[model samples]
Target: MLALKAENISKQYRLGEVGTGTLSHDLNRFWHKVRGKEDPYFKIGEANDRSSKGNSDYVWSLRDINFEIEQGDAVGIIGKNGAGKSTLLKLLSKVTKPTTGKIFTNGRIASLLEVGTGFHPEMTGRENVFLNGAILGMTRKEIKRKFDEIVDFSGVERYIDTPVKRYSSGMYVRLAFAVAAHLESEILIVDEVLAVGDAEFQKKCLGKMGDVTKGEGRTILFVSHNLPSILQLCKKGILLEHGLLKESADISTIISMYTHNAESEDIIPNSNKDVYLKSFKSYTEDDLESNLQTAKNGVLEFNIYSNKNLKNVKIGIGFNDDMGNRLFTPFSGHFQKMFDLSIGENTIYCTLDNFPLKSGKYTCEIYIGDNTETLDYYDKGLIVNVKDNFTLEKPDYSQGYFIINQKWTNERK
Candidate 1:
């Protein structure tokens, strides 16, 4: 059975010169409510024209969004910031109402869109746990059954009795997530709240979410800036752009479209001109320039070009495993010496040596930045295919990621 459904859900907000929404709009809405009539300005929703750039007008945060989630389906809502992914989740969670359209949900919907959501800062972590669970429609006894596990999962057992206001931003997020995950909610709506946690905690949350969708058979709506997370945890993805639904389908395909569309507009064609940063093409021997794929032990090279009077351009390549873990980071800066190049054009070469990696794909990230900060970033510079390395004895298959050439001796007493 379908757990949740939304049809033509849309939200509009009035923009101000500075701030998150305006109190003036709120007052106008309130005064109109007392008069028992719609506000005359309701027809003039946020304006989009450049002439009215700074004027007070309602802007659509979500427009004509439609989707359905079946039981145990993990749907990822992805788009650039301000694309209404969060607004959609907020409407679904009932934190905010849509300006138009309707939604039907079969079960209790719990959402964790921000840190300390539905939490009382004055209350202790232990108290907030119960409070949050109760707000999610859980009975006291039901929350009691999962209390200990929630505390453990949050890693805040020591401070369970401490006021949440005293906790660090990270601690608040941890406890909030713990309550959201443990409480009995058939439908889950999670925004980028996971991004606040450290790497380990984020991984833990991902595993927990996976368990919820796979083992517990719950429906989930997740929004995230981490594309790889969406690709990993979601079977389906919904793309939203400029308050409109772009597409929804296989997670990988949607993410590819988003990634491509995101970069297509900003990226100038590869040129040999005097600029801050130049674009390099990713290609293979057969001239398959885009989406190049190779078998294990494959060789791929970047056709790098430099077109400025440059010094100290620290060129580097980073390798990330399929799960988005940084496997290796090597840079020319390690050598301390900068490349001396002519003004018009030049090429820098990088080759993957030894290729001990197992059969899987790896993403190469290229960087060209000032010594202090990153000026330009190119993720998925090249996707290299690593074929299986035939070992003499059946591979142990126990070691985690990256072939480690370590010597070990075992002794039994």
Candidate 2:
């Protein structure tokens, strides 16, 4: 069943001043309306490309977007900044109207698009919960029935009676999410506002969203820059580029396309005459290139060219998934080790014993520096692909990203 559908949706905004300009564009539009013809400015509007300057005053934040989301399906809307991600969410949430086309939805929508979106700053948290519930078409009886659960989930019981204006940003999001998730809204819309929360709180929110979709059978539209979270929570993906709907497909395919096209490996040069990264590579136990396969014992090696001898240098490596979501970062300082760089060249190697990463493509980020300043940094320096071996049968990617070696014991009663 289709829970939501958007047809030829587009939103346009002026570049600088509001109201179409100094009465010229407005008069032009009015003249077109009087003649029963299409607006002339519509044809002159340009795409919302933030990187380049356009000649037109009006830009389309979203243009000709068409998609259908099935009931109980979680869809992730992903794109670079100023790619019209938030604009689409706002259009769907009715925060703003599209300049053209229409949207149809089957059920009530509760959106947590931003911090304190529907909150009244002067109202108490307890009052705001009832107000938001009422706005979502819930009766007072229903609000009261779920009030305790919402307060408990938010973890702001002590501040429930206090005015929300005094609450912190984290507190605002907690209460907003609790109300949006717990209330009887068949569809939920969440933007990148979740990035404001801490890591543990974000995990908890993701778990709650999972429950909402899988356990309660609700529809969700999530917009985020965090690719791992999108991959973990959504089954479908919609990619937008410069206000246009680029692709809509299964999550994995969309992720692959997005990552491959956006992949970059540029080494940043430092101003100081210190150490700089020259090359980085990974090798398997067989001394073969680790681009495809690596044995249990693999080595990540890098070379640094230095102008002068240095001591107490810090080196760090970050492992990220294809979509540029960092999984883990290991630093030399964390191991209580100091690095010394010779004047000409220096080599550093990190060994992976019994590499636990599952079969997948990963990117490596390299950083070389000291406590005071950074010498060199490379984003997506090297690409490593881990292949599945005969070590395990039927590996599960959903259980976790990596395979943990652990002993299992059974007690028979």
Model 1, 1-413: lDDT tens per residue? 98988888877776653422467866877799899988555566652333235445567777778888888999989876667788888889998788779999999988898988898989999999889888888899999999999999999999999999999989999999988887989998999888778879988999999999999999888997665676678999898887788898988778667766443113333343342334444333343443222222223343345565766667776767646778877677887846655575556654444455554555556766546665455552234444454545544546755653445779655
TM-score, candidate 2, is: 0.75
Give the backbone clash total of model 1. Answer: 6
What would you estimate as the lDDT of candidate 2? 0.83
Question: Model 2, stretches more than 4 Å misplaced?
Answer: 264-329, 338-359, 363-413
Global lDDT of each candidate: 0.72, 0.83
* lDDT (C-alpha) at residue 141 in model 2: 98
Best by TM-score: 2
What TM-score would you give candidate 1 relative to the actual structure?
A: 0.68
TM-score for each of the candidates: 0.68, 0.75
Write one digit per residue (lDDT tens) for candidate 2, span 1-413: 88899999998898887745668878988999999999887787899988898898889999999999999999999877788999899989998899889999999999999999899999999999999999999999999999999999999999999999999999999999999999999999999998778778888898899999999999999987666678789999999999999999998887776665553222333436567777666666665644324237767777788998888998898888755578887788888777988897788887777677777767667788888987877652255567665454757678867765566779655
